[model samples]
Target: MSLRTGETIKFRSVGERTEYAAKILSADEDTIVIETKPGARPELSAGQYVILIAAETNYNAQIMSADASQVRLRWLRTDKQEYFRVDDFFPVVARKVEKNLLDTKASMTVTFSKEAIDRSPPDETIHPKLWDLLVSLDEKLNLILDRLNLEPEPVEAEPQQVNISASGIRFMIKDKVEQGDMLEVKMLLPTTPMVSIVAYGQVVSSECLGSAGYVVAVQFVNMDSEVRDRLIQYTLNRQREIIRKQRQLE
Candidate 1:
């Protein structure tokens, strides 16, 4: 995606090895200018590379200049050999997507009850006692579903690798999927206070990865901002933990 003025962009500081977000101040065909805070000396120097994460794609950019007011970056094309090495410096595009639970029992129960109620006789075929029992059962199921912390059911027996972030998810699937196919993705984030996000996505890419398995990438469509923020926060926390473990080992 083209960088627009006032759009927030993420890049890593080559020196500090820390990621920072900046707002684009202006952009042209050759270079894009981003605002920098005063008193914060630039951590990136001219000719150094920083990975600019644009949506699902990452771009390797060379720093042209760094000043108190702004920093200029020249984007490199994907055809460049150095562009492929961008992930070596910063793996911003590689996100962890663990297979997770997707609870649909409540919804299923509701649907089943509705069907049962509709099929029941209007006045005489079903006994009053049986009708009362059905009503009681429906009430009980609803009570169970109304809980804040509902027991989750695993969608798969074992976890599969799914590259995921707040923005989207990419996972292997055997089922045929077409580009732009709409899907309702339900996932449970295995974090403290366990967040459940039910998001809709459109299949962006699906390629056969061999053995009848297809790797499908889906982009979230009109997702709630709050859930997206929570996913982002969860990813950040996981990254921190990974960094801490690496430091300990070193």
Candidate 2:
């Protein structure tokens, strides 16, 4: 879709999932100049990514600049890139999934398991809680195997801080991994069923955390759709919990 000047489009900041309308000032194949709507404040920063969605089509773009008057955006994709103008940028609802990706503490484990590792089935084909029980049994089995000097399935130590969402995760590790390294991530979501998701992620960014360790960030390169939906639901529930706690305190 091509948008002309004076047209508005929906805009969303990637990190915070903040949404707002922006009127187009000028546009081309790759870049667009949009005017932020009056009285609407979008906390956008340069170098951050944003999504511009219109007519059910979404375009990912990088924020070049933003001020009271206008925001500059550069399209992230070359293929299927569309121009926009002359439409009202409406505020889009926050993505519950993305919002919960913020840094949080959780019981998570990360490891460099083989990429093609075979997935174990059904955990006794019982309830979700039963599945967790099966996992505990498996852990006990591993411990037994260890005492016998047998090489059991490797399990890493529990992660201290796991910043996760359906899209990716960031955590601190003792060893530094090169950017683009692929690893397996297993996360136990504290939901009703307490879902356990095993997925593969590619290291996107890594930095030294000084005396603590190295902070590594990974983007989910592969995951099941159902698993992603569960993450969204888990995050939404977490948000409600925080609000409830605050109300009690007040």
Candidate 3:
């Protein structure tokens, strides 16, 4: 579902299902950058392209790297025990495409997926603030989605409640939750999770929820494979959805 590096997914809602690849440039908190072009990298606005407008049928892309002049933040990876060079992952800002939006450089509603690979070359350098945002966005979204999608089903021939907890945060769910239920997934950090991560989900069928662990036995529908996949794109695209977005981000 997540258009990862060398991976592909279809976009059905808008038009014919078009497949796209991912090119992760930088991955973090608020923002993520991807090298849209394949093969070798290019200069400013090189192969990178973006939709000059979202109304036309034809598509175009350009550099979307964030400017180096903006603010910079120190990115510390607690688990990795390393700090991402502040200016190593700067995002190049380009525009995004939609049916009808004034993002001729507007901040589009971008999302990421949890399933992505690492394409961030150690030599891939960028500005400071942008890099920090990418890292933060990636980690935050992954943690949020994992917990947000956590729900419990009532075991047959049993009487009990489905309680979910992980990392540190905890919550209780009603017995036998239907698909598409809105689960509150709070981050376990020493703080609160993003209010936006508490998203609305649709009930999906059991067969669609992949066979991962005992989760498949659950009702599985709050988000079907398609929706879940898209969310996964939004959820995991941070580091892996680069090539796909590059083709579409324009």
Candidate 4:
């Protein structure tokens, strides 16, 4: 899968080897930027550029610059940007396909095959719920995902702007989250101490943000598996209802 500007991602912190769920703020061959959540909040512009590791894929990147709005980055392996971008999008012209020029274009539109454009570093996919879950992240969470090494899909750039913020959805462990386990979360309003009704989840990812705190990514992991898929269905339904009512008022 090739990387693009708007895709969602999950990457790990290099040193402590913590996992952070993130979105690609921007990506170039040499630099990239991400907007993360929670622990890195209101203080977004001031936090340090953490060392990050990518789970499964073994992708690693360094935070070159950071702020409340975004964090700049440098990939250590390729010594380039980590995420693939529209600029990198291109069609497999039988000729250019040789040079794979189109594979490296960044114009927001490109055509390629399922096998031809392996833009992702490796082991990344477009998990349907990942982006939906990312819609409500805080500054600390922002910090975490901004550096995400997402499972990527080879996407053709669309004109619509890619969303970079978190899921406004905040998480809490219904049970103690063990290493490599699942958890639960809630849909909260976007802000510090974000609050909301209880929901279910899983721990797909985690990161120790140092003595400061821990950054973990949960994929509505188990509520669905247990409640026999009841919790997720309910949560998604509630979100739709809320959107419906919101549109009605508007």
User: Which candidate leads in lDDT?
Assistant: 2
Candidate 1 residue-wise lDDT at 235: 70
What TM-score would each prediction reach against the true structure? 0.40, 0.40, 0.19, 0.26
lDDT of 1: 0.54
How would you encode candidate 4's per-residue C-alpha lDDT over 62-175 as one tens digit per residue? 455666556677543331222211111111100001211211211111111222222333335655455434543323244222221212432221112111112212222222
lDDT of 2 at 211: 80
For candidate 1, the C-alpha RMSD (Å) to the true structure equals: 17.4
> Which stretches of candidate 4 lie above 4 Å from their native place?
40-55, 79-250
lDDT of 4: 0.36
Instruction: Arrange candidates, best lDDT first.
Output: 2, 1, 4, 3
| TM-score (C-alpha, index-matched) for candidate 1 | 0.40
What are the per-model numbers of colliding residue pairs?
0, 14, 63, 65
For residue 38, give model 4's deviation from the true position in Å. 3.9
Tell me the tens digit of each residue's lDDT in model 1 across 1-250. 6677998877664323566677899877667788766754446667555666657565545578887768898653321221000001101111122212111111111112223344354699789788876765554344334322313542231235666776667776666765545555555444433344556655656798678677777666454657666667767777777679789999
List model 2 lDDT by residue over 209-242, tens digit each. Answer: 7887677776654345666666566666666776
Cand. 2 Cα-lDDT: 0.55
- What does the lDDT read for residue 209 in candidate 4? 50
| Candidate 4, poorest ten consecutive residues by summed lDDT | 87-96
lDDT of 4 at 140: 23
Q: How well does candidate 2 score on lDDT at residue 71?
A: 86
Model 3: runs farther than 4 Å from truth? 1-126, 138-193, 196-204, 208-211, 214-244, 248-250
